[model samples]
Target: MTVLASSAPVLEVSALTRAFGGLVAVNVIDLAVHSGEIVGLLGPNGSGKTTALNLISGVLRPDSGTIRFAGQAINGMPAHRIARLGLARTFQLVRVLKGMSCAENVKAGLVFHRPPLSRGEIDESVDRLLRHVGLSDRGGLPAAGLTYIDCKRLELARALALKPRLLLLDEWLAGLNPSELLIGIELIRSLKEEGLSILLVEHVMDAIRSLCDRCVVMNSGRRIAEGRPDEVLADPAVIEAYLGVSPGVSTDA
Candidate 1:
């Protein structure tokens, strides 16, 4: 797994802004991810975390600002083109096709690489990913029949199929129970070991503190604090915005 340490920035966002009619979804946000790092993006509900991911993934165009991937300008590129550039993301809601099997759902991710690989190679890669996610035996199951956790895993498997240099995940653990959260956290940790850069938007404070090297806190579509997880979590403004209490405030006081 790869962890960031003052290395070259793999993904850069410069003054990114997005709006929906009268609403400013993402407001002039600037952020970056290095070659090997796990960076956490956190905020309360309706914060711009998801909007930022969509802009970065090209799922939605930015009203202003720029995005660069691997040092190349990619602001206006289509989502598929961005995927081809080694950037992939999983949605907060698993978006697998109900009619497809688990293996087929993941196979869709492999499509970006183009000109199909030899059947042997394809099978080996798919099987390995399935096994890695502990779903080898379930690969043939219809996606609609899989449990919610399995659907999340399938989403992850599909994202990994792109061989992404950076993975953007939106609340991957949302709706999961304790056991499922643990598995997701462990999987992410393992991916970091494999040198995959990750930008995760999560509401789970424990997961962020344990798994992230740094945290970026956003409020009302703008970044308010960023640093080591503990430091950011302790910021007064961050606590006020999300935790509903200012840092150092005591109920007795």
Candidate 2:
């Protein structure tokens, strides 16, 4: 895979803002994500992390902003159109067809706004994706029967079926146990090694600290800081906004 140059951002957002009525859900925010890197977006609930992802993935239109992916404007493009442009995102909510088999569910992703392929091709493609996500043997099972963690993995696999240049993931580890969290983290790491750029919105501190090369913290619809994991996590502003004060942690913000 061809790696992207550091100077040229794979995704860029300038002055992104979204509002509903009199309330601003996301204020003017600017961000740039380079290829082959994982950048975490974290904050308290309603901090606009998911909203930011929605805007980038074209699920919701930004009230004012410019989003350029690979040098092309995609701010107002529909979600399906964005996917065709090598961007794909997974929802915070698990969106699986309960009655469908795992293989069938994965196949759905491949057909997202794309021309249909032959059955044999779809099967081969889905099987390869399932294997990549460590779900090869589970493909024949119904989606509803899989455990919560497996379901999450299935979602990741489906997202990868798009062969995206950039992926926006929203809080995928929400309901997972410790073991599941580790597995999920490992899978994300593997993807990064495969040269996929990622922007993840997650609250799990451990995952963010371990998986992301850098992070951006948001609070009340505004950016607080952006830097390496340790530097950003240790920032007084981030700790105050998310972790709250403790006797041992710094109180100044």
- In candidate 2, stretches whose alpha carbon ends up further than 4 angstroms from where it belongs are 1-5, 113-117, 244-253
lDDT for model 1, please.
0.88
Q: What is the C-alpha RMSD of each candidate to the true structure, in Å?
A: 1.8, 2.8
TM-score of every candidate: 0.95, 0.91
lDDT of 2: 0.87
Q: Which residue pairs does candidate 1 place in steric collision?
A: 1-192, 1-193, 1-194, 1-195, 2-192, 2-195, 3-36, 4-36, 4-37
Task: Determine which window of 10 residues in candidate 1 has minimal summed lDDT.
Answer: 1-10
Taken over the whole model, the C-alpha lDDT of each candidate is 0.88, 0.87
Residue 39 shift from truth in candidate 2, angstroms: 0.5
What TM-score would candidate 2 get against the native? 0.91
**Tens digit per residue, CA lDDT, model 1, 1-253:** 2444557898999999998989998999998998778999988888899999999999999989999999999997899999998999999888888899888887888887555677787777788888888798777899999889888888889899888999999999888899888888999999988889999999888799888988888998999999999998888998899767787778683
